[model samples]
Target: MLPAVAVAAVAAVAVAVAVAVPALRHRLVRSALRRAGGRYRRRLEALSSDVRLNQERRLRRLLRAGTGTGTGTAGGWEEFQQRHPLGQPCREEAPEDAVPPLWLWALLPGCWDCDPRLQGSLLYLDALGTAFPRALSRRGTALLHWTPGCPRAPAGWPLPTLYCTPAAAGTVPSRAAALRLQLLFALRQRELHVLEAGLAAELHDALVALRTEWPQLARELALGRLSPQPGLPEEVQRQLQALLAPDAARAAELRAECARGFEGILQRLWPQLEVVVVRMVHGSERLYCNSLLQAECQGLPFYCPFYQAAGALLGVNLWPAEPEPRFLLCPDWAFCEFLPCLANKEPQTVLLDELWEGREYRLVVTAQPGEYRCRTGEVLKVTGFHKQCPVVEPVRRESQTLSVRGEDIPEEQFCQSLCRTLRTWPGARLIDYACVESSLLGDFSGPCAPHYEVFMELQGLRDLSEGQRYKLDQCLQEDFPIYKSFRFKGSIGPLRLHLVRPGTFTRLREALGSPRPMPRVLHQEQLLQLVQGSIIS
Candidate 1:
């Protein structure tokens, strides 16, 4: 009743002020709608946990017998897993098909939307068809065109071009196109339900591009700490300004909530630019890995389990209630929580049911159509669990972990150190980065000592001083105790950091195909040569 009375009072004030300030009336109404929608969505999320697993089961049934016949909801998953005890691991050798297992079906259920009931409202960085691995992919969007029950794309969201064009093949977007699309998506949040994009690296590029293209708006939203960037639609410019009020309290609040770095910049432009990063394992494109939500942004490639989108199903919200569970895996989609029978001979596998928090596991999937079992080279660590669904963090790719001299620093720790170093560097919006173990270097490249070679593509801070270069080495020491020990013992040499030419990664991505992502950990000499050639003085 108190809340209702307060809302009523606010409404009364808006009406009373409307007569004197007609222009501001629409603004107040629009703000009210966004707030009200937020409240409604939160209410839905609160109720989602109760029915999430049910919805997932419903989805799995629709995945077509891609997992094979004889599998039903009743203890069938256990039986199926026993029969296919082990499957082949993901390799560089390409498969005949790269589509999601669901592609076998004529039309993927439109429920991948926040809810099947809410039609034509989803807007992603790439069309679902365009998303590599194509989890829900094209058929999902095509349904919106054919079925009346399917939700239609909302006004001003650009579904046809954004969804169907040559641009649909995502992974790499040209700077100019990326900036325009990103700015458009940032403003569209006033109405849409969810806005999905690729990994953290790609999202950083978008945000950096956002600031580069619209300095004034970025400055005001970032509370002037970050330098200015330019160009935007007038209405969008007004909306972005509205996000940052002139009042001291609001400004202070913004400053306090946002400090420095991409994380801070993200907070400053949030709600309006709520971008979620989807991290799909590179080699195995058909399997959905996980996603990083706006709240859990760590400035790295990490995410909550893919099926946990229960908020969209049960609550229609981006966040979920406590004990956050994953929607049940399809009976057709078998998972392995078992340990590998061999040692370093095989990758580490996490025991899902008996998951020990902080321990890493190789995420395995049999979700692809006609595939027996494929051990995803991706590493996911158990963070927490909701009911039976495990909440996981994609730690790193198994092959990406630097193992020279047995220091074996995981990618996440390396990323954490890199991010920390970035915060201290001047004009840092780390666009794309790759790590190379000295082991990849040929005998002629110095003594071929064990160390790390890091290549970075940054938007600002043209060059680094000796001290700035040293910070990365210091940071890596902090992240990996063994690495520090190895350095101290002289077993490992110092880490080398390089600033690469702008568009180096872009050109590399183009060479790799628009749908393909650049490898984060460069193991091959060929890939290193391309990066080496692009390094700036």
Candidate 2:
């Protein structure tokens, strides 16, 4: 019985050992597997991040090279494709048929003003056509598929077909409404493509939210009524308000979603496109040439020849010698006094006046038929003057007097004033001048002329080069002049200026002399310091 009990105990011990050993081995294997999986995931994430970073850098370079005076052609396309290689199928596709080809995509939408609906629709379409290529190019085409609506499909459009719901179709009331629907649809398509392409799940959700909000805003815009305003036309306000209601909660929600989505998109897209967001400053000031003298007094404001000529043609109301004068003095008193004296059956004289010690004096002036008095100051009493000024060759005056405030002058004058104040400084050069208008926003209303704002592009002591050009651009950005009532708006390209050479500059200085006075040297010194600080870095 003792031997049998001992055997049972040994058997029990052996069974216990078997169970313990297997359990230990299993735990070890499980731990090793978990560690390996964790390392693998980390490695994958790092690789993805690096890949995205590289792609972004390449895209940024491409965009920078393409903008502003670069050849935006097939070569640009080739370079882009080479940098961002498509997969095997895309590589096999011909240039004409391939979506990535620059020729296939329209960079800017066509001008279509007559139909508001069509215009809105086309604008969205153009944006998609332009942006999708870049997105897919970066993310790869496997994530995207194109589809067209039934109407488009019937017309043999190459994109993937997406059906517009009957309810959605009915919701669109006007041609403009239909256009907006199309735009939203295109945006939705792009969003899905981005998601499918393995973008973050959060990005997809944000985009979905954004698309849903667009339609609600559009509906509100369509329903809103117009109000009276100066800058905003009634029709425009009505349409815009309905589309983007200021108070609507849905609109705000949509805006937030869009902002989030766009940021994500930009983060991904910016690097690939090589896009640089250039900061632009706008101004509001009118540009005008000083027209005070001619011949002996050429370009001088306070002198004769020009002034006398102006007076002979148009009756002056006040003479220069008058004490407390009320009117300009002129020889053509008959024309100033309303007598018909010109051969063209028109009056050639007008009156100019100044008020001194509460008394008004009249100065007679004669001028060509087209010339009109632009001076504003004191009231003048004309003994006799005529109203009719016919368009004929009566007498041509080379220059006329211009009244400017003590503060206002050409950009050159400001620079010169500063140089004069700092007599020790080297002379400055007028490198460039800009009559910048107050907005950078493009106007679809056509080519409107610049307004009151003007900026003088002056070069310091630095030599001219591409680097210098860049520095100048930077300096302008930093030390930009501030206008209390006017702000810088937009840039008009290919700036043209009647540049004055060194000789011409000297001539102007000699002509103006002590009368006009040189610009303050201190002002120039300050400007130099400001420009140096701005551009040097």
CA RMSD of all predictions: 13.0, 33.1
Candidate 1 local Cα displacement, residue 254, angstroms: 23
Model 1 accuracy (lDDT, Cα): 0.46
Q: Which whole-number lDDT from 0 to 100 does residue 13 have in model 1?
A: 93
RMSD of 1: 13.0
Candidate whose TM-score is highest: 1
Candidate 2 per-residue lDDT over residues 188-254, each given as its tens digit: 2222222221111111222333345554543443434223323333443444444432334433444
* TM-score result, candidate 2: 0.18
Per residue, candidate 1 scores C-alpha lDDT tens digits across 160-212 of: 22222112212122333433444433432232223344333344444445444
What is the TM-score (0 to 1) of candidate 1? Answer: 0.52
